[model samples]
Target: MHERVATTPSLMIKRRLNATPAEVFEAWTDAKLLMQWFGPENVVTQEVSVDAQVGGGFRVVMRENTGERHEVRGTYSEVVANEKLVFSWSWITTPERVSRVSVTFKPDGAAGTILTLLHEQLFDEQAVKGHTHGWTGSLAKLEALFA
Candidate 1:
């Protein structure tokens, strides 16, 4: 007989932005634009570097109001202009726990973009919860950009 173990579920998040797919994609790939709305509310972006292509990498550092710094780095696995992007994500502090993130941009009617984000391979349930919180906050900031 073989034993099996259960795994944590992947996180899926969706948002609708009042902008075109190109604009939403640019906000993700362009370092300058990303820095403007990459982190949670009240978290200041200290540094941002992005190479928006397959096999390229990105790094973002944010400082909280309490001066705590959080850094995340990732490598691009797939990139489709204004359509989709897939990447590997790992925290600088815990590179051993690598995860994958995929984002798809779909045109909604004529002006809005429907953004779907799926984050998988999380190490544990705690990671899923933490990422859910972080992503929710980040997405809110991203949404504000188009408002």
Candidate 2:
């Protein structure tokens, strides 16, 4: 018998947005909008391609000021407009390793949306740490944009 092994890290992030759930979800689904604020200040996406429907493909190439590049690609597992999205994410540089991510948008009250993202199934310690930092930093930028 073979033992099952975990292959990706997990992370959770929550933030409130001034926009509606529909608008927040749209920012996540649209490649152009995602590219505008995807990474840290020192990093920027050079290109993004996304097909937000089930089994659809998505890819993004992010480059740092020093020209280092990281490529991420995945396929959507589930998509529910304005409410939730589920997808399998992979770092192309780390072949055969994949992570699961779920993002939910909830109407917080009258005029704002609460966005929560959960990423799971990580492989190693480094991955967990890296993703935690990345998600926290990225969400901060997103919040700043709305502020």
Candidate 3:
């Protein structure tokens, strides 16, 4: 008999944005704003649908420069305006490999917000690295929005 071993990897990212906590939170909850900065730099967001409430859901479709499309969907588990959000995340094509993402926003003095993102329950180390790269790129775009 063979025994199966499972691995769970996680990643955390911190970003400082030149915007208020409310503005940063709005960028996440508002579908239009989300699409503008959600994906990696080389991918274009094709469509975005967001229902910003606890138990609500969101879907995002992104098209790579190569014309390939990737879709992700998730349901909100917790929502606290201008403070925090927790959601379940899964790719449409790999729904079985579900993960969770939590984002916290705090005021950084009077001029900015400190944003922390934690992604957990990843399937493996590869997933952790991939998500880290993706989130790094996406957060750069989010920062540009306030620049």
Candidate 4:
């Protein structure tokens, strides 16, 4: 494993969700659910495909308010039911700059879940900044879905 230096650009988001771990996990792996909240603000997800298993692939296609289309696809490297997922992340426009994303759902007190998302191995600070904005937006939508 490569140890990340202090300057290695990465993003981490932690939020308390008003749902169980299983529910939160399902929201990530289910196509229909993902379509509802898979993109940043002003980006409407048009299609979603998920095979939530190790070595499986997932793709999400979205359209921005300006009518620009964006697609992201990745392969699952690790999947732990109701607990965690690790996947590669690459946008169609910049497929050469592949990154990694990991999400973990931990049981919080009384039916709630503490979700932590760590996005690493980004190409640079710019990529990290962009992804941070996008992910935070999407996660906010997810939070509202379970709220």
Best by lDDT: 4
lDDT of 3 by residue, 121-141 (tens): 999889888899889999999
Candidate 3: deviation at residue 20, Å? 0.2
Question: TM-scores of the models, in the given order?
Answer: 0.93, 0.90, 0.94, 0.95
Model 3: worst 10 consecutive residues (lDDT sum): 3-12
- Sorted by lDDT (best first), the order is 4, 3, 1, 2
lDDT of each residue in 1-147, candidate 2, tens digit only: 999655555778899988888888888889888887787778888999989999998898999899999898888999999999999988889868888889999998876899999989888888888888877877777777667
Candidate 4 per-residue lDDT, tens place, 71-105, comes to 99999999999999999999999999888999999
List candidate 2 segments past 4 Å from native.
1-9
Quantify all predictions' global Cα lDDT against the true fold: 0.93, 0.86, 0.94, 0.95
lDDT of 3 at 127: 89
Show model 4 residue runs off by greater than 4 Å: 1-7
At residue 119, what lDDT does model 2 achieve?
Answer: 88
Candidate 3 differs from the real structure by a C-alpha RMSD in angstroms, to one decimal, of 5.0
Question: Superposing all C-alpha atoms, what RMSD in Å does each candidate have to the true structure?
Answer: 3.5, 3.7, 5.0, 1.9
Off by over 4 Å in 3: 1-7
lDDT of 3: 0.94
